[model samples]
Target chain A: MRSVILSITAVLLALLIGAGILLLSGASPIAAYSALVHGAFGDAQAWQRTLEKSTPLVFSGLAVAFAFKAGLFNIGAQGQLLLGAIIAAAVGFGVEGLPAVVHAPLALLAGAAAGAVFAAIAGALKVYTGAHEVITTIMLNYIAINLTDYLANGPWKDTSPGNIVARTPRILDTAALPTWGPVPSGFVLSIVLAAIIYWLLWKTTFGFEIRTVGQNRHAARYAGIRVARTVILTMLISGLFAGLGGAVETQGVVGRYQPGFNVGLGFEGITIALLAKTHPFGVIPAALLVGAMKAGSSQMQFVADVPKEIIDVIQALILFFIAADFLLRRLLRLKAEAGEERLVLSTGWGSGE
Target chain B: MNPWRTLWHYNRGKVLAAAALVVFVVWAYTRDPQIVEAVLASSLRLSIPLILGALCGLIGERSGVINIGIEGQMLLAAFVAFLVNVYTGNLLLATLSGMLVGAVLGFFLAFMSVTLRIDQIIGGTVINMLAFGLTGYFYQVGLVTKGKFAPIPIPGLADIPILGAMFFRNPPLTYLTLLLIFVVQFWLFYTPWGLRTRAVGEHPRAADTVGIDVYKMRYLNVTLAGSLAGLAGAYLTLEAVGSFERAMTNGQGFVALAVMIFGRWNPILAWGAALLFGFATALQTQLQFMNAAQIPASLLWLKQIPHQFIGMLPYLLTIIVLAGVGGRTRPPAAVGQPYVKE
Candidate 1:
């Protein structure tokens, strides 16, 4: 319970600091925030878009958090997401005549599998050899970006007589994921998937092994767990989630894949996962908050002409405070309450294991 | 046998990388002889910037820093170098400004990550993001409003045999890249300061016990990396193009990082990897002349081959190589650990 208080306190402090920065930048903080709120959730339509945006963030954030739980920093979510989107789009476009029920899930499966394979490249290297994932994953992102760009530009290009942008042909209608009114069916699926991920992380034996591996590899090995296998598997699962996010983006919202349209969605998952303190369940609200901020940015620009850079400043400040969280704890004179396990996991870089 | 164990047992990544290299050479031959010559030459020429960029990675990481903001550092250098070049038209002045900006960025990163003990990754990310945003904004507001910079090739040097015909013929800025690689290599292996830098990287606490200022050395190396990375950007604008374009470094910073790893974190090895990446890139561009070839005909995937996979090759191969020869060496012990001095 006290952990909840800590998180909420962090959120409030971040908002306050963000507000202070906005005021200094000469924007009417109150009005700008009001516009931000209105833009994100003032209407039914806005709520739908916010939920839509949150769907991808949920999966991607969880993808990153899952890896953290298993003691790897899987920075290739962007690449995984790209491979997922590309393969899913390929299936969605290439396969015709399948029934709607079979088609949507099949495309989704293909996307997830592609992302898994792509992600496995990094995992396999890390496990079998001794490559640092942080480097490979970042490199893979460039490959994914360029590969996706090339495919969209060339062979798989929309080729619609009038089109020029690097993107895929629209997925067939039968392949599209259905929606419930303005709220997407995919969002509900994402929520359910989040619960499942939480279960797999906290309740299951495999989850126990994974967290054990993350906590300390040598200790887990002593307990008869295979450290390398767990690390690779965790990365594979992480890739699957990111892939699912991309699949949802295609079937639920965009309807087609366009290179460069989505720049920081996967990388932003890092921020969301971190802000959530690597909690699977906590990722929901954290992703939603970020989703709302992103969704509202354009409207914020429209209403206030306050450069969107202010949001980045707010985010950086929040991350700064979170990284130096001890400062806040000291400043607030908060006693260290027992049993609040705050974000304990190994980064590939620093942890002794 | 399990694939993982098998991979560990045999360690085929380097063997695979070598095979890939042989295959590429063969493919180059199968294309037009003239085109292959030009492509090889072009690839070697292209290797210059990437070598320098990789060197930047080498300096910082060897001494326990990961400079993800190499892109931003490059951008700042390119932008500032362009401005200085427009006013003075002197290549030396342009290069100095670039190195200066990069050093400042590097120092700033080291201060935050080493001194304040911020999450080095986050600190690096902020630097990258800040660099992108700052440069992007200024290029739009200031440079475009002001004017553009022009490229200046060195006199007669570009006309000499082989070296002059290929490298010197292009631009004076290009040679700076080659010089930096050798200089960094020398500094790392020869200098007493280099030995101390390595000492701090291997085990900062131990170095501290031995009376070396770990924080100070890290700061110095990281800042030096920033300046070199910045010079890479200056070369991009002043030598390659006349003006700074938005996000023009275009992931080269990350590529340099891959080169750093592929180079096994040695400056010379980094230069070798940079050259390979450059060659692959040049081949991709040069292969356009062979569009009508019998080979490129069968493998249209070959067209997307180098562009997509070449970009991805280092990353994919890094894992491959590591698996093949796991633990031949290791990153510095204190790499990425924020030093919050007690």
Candidate 2:
């Protein structure tokens, strides 16, 4: 209950800061916020946009949240998502003459597999070489950016008439994700995945092992949990989630593999995961909130002449409040948690020894 | 095992990195002897911001604060410096403003980590996000072109053969970067303050017990480090590139962290690593300009490589370097830990 109250307070404070910024910029906060809400949920198309935007955030958020259970910070979600997206697009376009069911699922699985493999590299490096995953994942993001750019611009360049951009050919109609009213099919899939992830995190033996490792690695080891395997497997699962996000993005939203279309969706995952407090179930509402902000940003800019980056600022502020919960505690005049005032994310460098 | 053999095993990654670089140099030299000097000069120029950024990380990390927010600091400083230069048209004031902004940010990071006990990485991430959003928003509304500082060549030194053109013919900011490398190296290893800073980073409790104010050292070091990143940002706007672009620092700040790891957390070694990264970046650009007809037909495959592939060189090299060498190097024992007062 305290956690929930804290979460609510952090969110309200972030919104307050956003409002303050809006006022300072000479834009009426109420007018701008009303426009934002209306833009995100006013109409059917607005709802669709919100859902579509929320779909990838859900997957990536779950990815990060799930890895956090294993005490791994998967900063490479962007790279992993990109790999998933491009590979899904590849499978979507490269294969021909399959029904929608077979082709779409195939493409999605391929994307998930690619993301898994990409993320597994960092995980394996951490396990085998004692190389910190943070640095490796960050470096890998750059490599992924360049690698995808090369693939798009070189071999996969769309050669259709009047096409000169760095993008892959459109996926076949059979591979497209169908929309059901305001909700995209991929969005529905992400919701299902979230539930499944919650179950995996709380109900199963593997989930127990992961949480154990996260809470106390030495205890996990004493309890006969294979720490390295658990860590690597957790990353693979996290990658799969991020990969599905990319696949859904390709099939549902973009229609083709374009470089810039999926630029910050992965990084936004960090925001979502943190906002959710690394809870699998909590990711849905958190993702929806952020998705609403993203969906409304352009409309806010158009209506209020306020820059869309304000949403980014708000998101950062949200993360800040969450990370520094003591700020909220002080503001609310609440006491700290019973035993410890802070939570551990990951152990410090070289402490694995 | 013999002691010498044990030491060799421990330093195995460094030896492997050296071998890789040697092989790369030999291969590049074999491909085109003339472009080597151009690449070297470009590498030196490109390394200035990287060296400064790495030094920022070095200082902060040495004080037991993980400042992944260096990128944010650089971006914010770059924006401030550009804004100041556009309005005031005073280069020194603009640069100082950038550094000042960076210091303020550093102070906030210190407050979060030292006072509030927030995770350093999370604090840094928040700072990066804020910097990106704020700079990006302002850039859209207020982005403009400003006059850039021109290279002030040192007369006799600039005339010297190859070294002069590469080392001396740079803007004042770049020279300061070069000079600070040695200064930081000497300070980190030789000075009393440096020793105390390292002690705080490695074992804060011990330092505190011995009457060293751990909080003060961390606060001062982090703020100073922020200024270093800020200066790097100022260089981007005032010297390297004259305008502020949204998130213009890109991932160079993160690469600087990799450079910090590559240098084994030593200032001089970090400088060398920064130069190596610069060389990798220059090599990418140089490789793109290689004449297809000049090279042997067998090596013509290089020309077929995509620009994006060439762009991957620096990042890929960074990954390899980290994977191979990161495990071998030791980080400060107390890094990323919030010092709680007893």
Candidate 3:
């Protein structure tokens, strides 16, 4: 409950800071903000776009949150997601003569599996060699970017007439994720997955092991848990979630794998995870909030003649406030509650030894 | 006792590096005699920012602060420096402005890690996001600079065969970075200040037990180190590219961290690592050029490789090097841990 309040305050404070930036830049804060709000929530179309944006964020947020539960920082979600999107596209377009039910599920599973395998590389490196995941994951992201770019432009280039862009061939109609009225099926899947993850974290024995390892690896080892196995499995599962996000994006919205279209979907997962305070269920609301901002940004730019990047600035400010909660607590005069569990994202480098 | 075997046993990294250099020289000479000088000169040119970024990381980590925000610092500094150059047409002022921005950012990181006790990684992420957003927000399309800094050839030295061309014929920042490599090497090992910084990083509690102020040492070192990263940023806009692009620092800052680990946090060794990585980058570009032209029969198959795969070479090499060396190197004992006075 207290965390909820803190998150709310952080958002408000971030908005205030954002307004100050607008004012200093000689723009009317009121006009810009009103346009932003109207653009995000004014119509059903706006809400639909928000939900579409939120779907990927939910998966990516869960990926980061799940890893955080194991005391690992999965900064390579971008890479994992890229591989997922491309593999899904490969299965979606290349494999012909399949029914809708079979093709869609196959593509999704293939993408998620690719993501899992990619993430496992870093996890195995951490366990066997004590190589820091933070560094390895970041390097993996660049590799994924280049590898995917090569696949799209070289082997899988859309060789159809007049297609010069670096992107894969469009998925078959049967493989595309369906939209029910105004709501996307992929968004529904994300919400259901979030619920399942919450249950898994709170109720399962494996989840107990993950939490224990996160809290103290030495204690977890003493208690007869295989800490190394838990770390690797956690990463694999985390990658699966992020990969699913990319799969959904390609099947639901993009209809194909394109480089620039999925640029920062994975990085935004970090912001959403932190904003949700690493809570599985909390990810939904946090993703929706960020999604709304993203949805409205273009309209805000059009209406107020302000740059769309202001949304990113506001989002960063919100993360800053949440990460440095003491500043917010001091301003609000809130007392620290006893036995509050602080978020521990990682131990320092070489701690794997 | 064989002298060569004894040297290998005592200094394995140096021996391996020398062997690699010998192989590279042989290969380049075989390809084309002039290729050696061209590749070496380009390698050194490409390594300027990387060497500076590694030095920045070296100083901060030696004082017990993990500066993952180096990328953000460089990006922001590059943007500010580019804007200054565009308006003032003075390269010196633009470079100083970039350094100032970096110093301020370093101070902010110090406050978060040392005073507020926020997680250092999270703090760095915040800085990165803020820099990316701010630069993108204010950047005007098609803003041009007057010109970039011209290379200054040292008269006598630049004319002295291939070796001189590799080292002497370079822009102002490249020369400064080369001199800084030796200066930092000496300062880190021979100065009393270096001793205190190491003490703070290794055993802050022990340093605190004596008269040394741990917080002060950290703040000073991190801020000063930030200026080096800022210098790297200035080099990007004012010296190297002569313009700013959003997130232009790319992953070089992170690569610097990998280089730092590969060098085992030593300044001189880090220079060697930066050069090796820089050589990989140079080779990739050269391979692309060869792919475009009519290549020799021996290397004809190289043309079949796609360009994107060539771009992946440096990043993949970083992962391989880190996996090989990460376990062997030890970081500062108290690095990444916020110090609290009892």
Best by DockQ: 3
Screening candidate 2 with a backbone cut-off below 3 angstroms (N, C-alpha, C), the clashing residue pairs are: none
**Model 1 C-alpha lDDT per residue in residues A220-281, reported as the tens digit of each score:** 99999988788888999999999988888888888888886557778778767877878888
* Residue pairs with clashing backbones, model 3: none
Docking class of 3: medium
lDDT: worst 10-residue window of model 3 chain A: A344-353
How much RMSD separates candidate 2 from the native structure? 3.3
| CAPRI class of candidate 1 | acceptable
Return the clash pairs for model 1, or none.
Answer: A129-B323, B11-B324, B12-B324, B102-B226, B102-B227, B103-B227, B158-B168, B158-B169, B263-B269
> Relative to the unseen true structure, what is the C-alpha lDDT of residue A158 in candidate 2, on a scale of 0 to 100?
83
Q: What lDDT tens digits, residue by residue, belong to model 2 across residues B1-342?
A: 343354356657665876797677667666765576578779988898888989999899899988888889999999999999998889999999999999999999999999988878788889999999888776655556568888888989987655676788888898888889889877877788988999999999999999999999999999988999999999999988898877788788888888887787877778878988898788667757877766668867777777777777777777776675555677898898888879
B179-283 in candidate 3: lDDT tens per residue?
998888778777889888889999999999987999999899899888889899999999989999988998888888888877778887788889989888887
Better of 1 and 2 by TM-score: 2
TM-score, ranked from best to worst: 3, 2, 1
The candidates' DockQ values read 0.26, 0.60, 0.64
What's the number of clashes in each of the models?
Answer: 9, 0, 0
Candidate 1 lDDT, B231-339, residue by residue in tens = 7888777766667777788777777776676666777666666777777677666654465554445656666554665656555554444443334555667677765
Docking class of 2: medium
Computed on alpha carbons, the lDDT of every model, listed in order, comes to 0.74, 0.85, 0.87
